[model samples]
Target: MASNTNLTPPRGLEGLDLLASAIIILDDDNRVVYANPAAEHLLESSVKALSQLRFTEMFLNADSLNAVFRQATENLFADWRQDLTLERSGREPLHVHCIVSALDKPGMAILIELRENVQQLKLDREERLLDQSQANKELIRNLAHEIKNPLGGIRGAAQLLELELPERHLKELREYTQVIVKEADRLQTLVDRLLAPHRRPHIVGDVNIHEVFERVRSLITAEFPSGLAIKRDYDLSIPEFRGDKEQLIQAVLNIAHNAAQALAPRIAAGDAQLIFQTRIARQVTLAKVRYRLALDLHIIDNGPGIPPEIQDRIFYPLVSGREGGSGLGLTLAQTFVQQHMGVIECASRPGCTDFRILIPLP
Candidate 1:
């Protein structure tokens, strides 16, 4: 479809871009004035493509739409809300809860908003994740600290006991003391790793998301030189945001590394594919705070998906899908992202797994 370049985006409507709901504005003649990013995604068309398109030309059936539009414009303050079905490409029907209200603007401006049926459920899940993240952090900190304090004494006691042993029995006793000392040191190291993210100071800098991707890409590509194909579907227009550059790199690398390991079977078949996809999300809400734009970065892999039983607990410490895996990779990644007021979400099935990292854009 050819775009209508003659139509320009309306002024004083920039705030509309910050809305989570899909919004469209129409002129008195029923020509589309503007379509927000959410609206464009809902309609499966861009603002430029939908611009200046007459109401009848845009929809397969315009009778109901016209009636609702008229009902809304008749009374400026009376907003008409109803469930409506829109035909897509003449086959698929999209069900939407639509609200048409009159805008107090020149030329009989009408504002139409479309909302997804599951939007509320999605928001509730996001809220739950944020709350759960907070609780998990506190629990981890207390648990790590509790285990950390006694470790030094246990190791020191083992050394003292070893030195006090008699010469003839020293060889056998030394072996026993060595085990205690080594095990204590191992546990101490584990505790330190658990507390690393929280203990380290966050260093903020202007981070280009693509640079982070490149660093991860280089590491994964070298690790799996053959049989695996790493693909990039990046939106180069994503603006640089303030974050800890190294933290972002580690967060992405952990996800990609997990993907590479899961792709082992596919790798042997020489058909494995890992994709790094990035897009700019408009009007993002994270941890109850809303931002004008956010980064939607996806690490997708065509490998066996996460097991159903442990899918929800993947972010928890010591939860591993692979055998002998420490499972701290994703936990640390989540911590690092959370430090930046961002979140990492996972969606997995049989053939595809998508790990999304969302951060508010600057």
Candidate 2:
């Protein structure tokens, strides 16, 4: 014998809280009835704080979202708008996809789902960068091999010609041969460096990012001893991760060295500064993989920032912002970091420049 009473569904929204997309429940009057954890994170407000406000209060242009909500309620179906802008005061407006559906329960008339458009853009950008890096590596390797073969033969021929020249009357001519040999050697070294990242075996070990920073600080201070000040703001709680120690050192050194060169005038005037900051980032997505924890290392410099004209292509091989620069330092640094499953990003202005490195932590 079964009871005649009907069983009611659970009133709490515990299931909605598990979703990565932001979820907001609204009452018939459009006031917020519930907000999940993802919604709290997206709004930068707690669930309790959000519940006190109406849906229209959270955005500058709420009319568009409201229109969709009205249609969904009237039709008794779900509706969604793509690339809708949600404005926040004192912050950049966010582009989000808004989904609205009517709920059958009382006091929860509608369910709204918000997904950030920037996140998809980030994923696409990472995919493009990874593809570009692979193409660059292949091009460099093939080009370097072609150049290397001719280089050895050129040097050998130059030396042989010098030995075969008339000993008594060809001293001045011998100098030309010597010049050819030196130039060939220089080119050979350049080719070797171009292929270095691919040829070198990765050495794995526990790496303290702070240690790498300290090493770079010491080296940079030694070179520009007088004017530049190196500052450290470290989050001591960040645990060590595994990586290639020497490669990390070289990657950071190249970036710091480039900054030092950019700060030449300020360095001479005794006012240059470089800051090394380390912190732990939570819920970060890098190279299409979401990480629970990632190491955020920022290298900040107080100097005339990167010129706006060439800012976009700074990481491309042979694209130097400074005159006489080979433009390979940053390229090599980007390669090394990418090999460690990390990414480097830069933000520059007239007086401040920041290079941020993000690597997942185990």
Q: Ten-residue segment with the worst summed lDDT in candidate 2? A: 1-10
Supply candidate 2's per-residue lDDT for 123.
Answer: 71
Residue 3, candidate 2: Cα error in Å is 60
Candidate 2 residues 1-362, lDDT tens each? 11111112226656786899988888777777777778888889886677677789888888667777777778755566576777789986767887788887766677889898888667767787788878888888899999999999999999999989997858889989999999999989889889999889999999988899999999998999999989899999887889999999999999999999999999999999999999999999998789999889899999899999988778888889899998899999999999889998899998899999988887
Using lDDT as the measure, the top candidate is: 2
Off by over 4 Å in 2: 1-116
Give the per-residue lDDT of model 1 (tens digit) for 252-330: 9989998999999999999999999999988887877889988999999998999999998899888999997888889
Candidate 1 C-alpha error for residue 83, in Å: 11
Q: Rate the local accuracy (lDDT) of all candidates.
A: 0.84, 0.85
Which clashing pairs does model 1 show? none
Residue pairs in collision within model 2: none
Q: State the displacement of the C-alpha of residue 248, model 2, in Å, after optimal TM-score superposition.
A: 0.6
Tell me, by TM-score, which candidate is best: 2
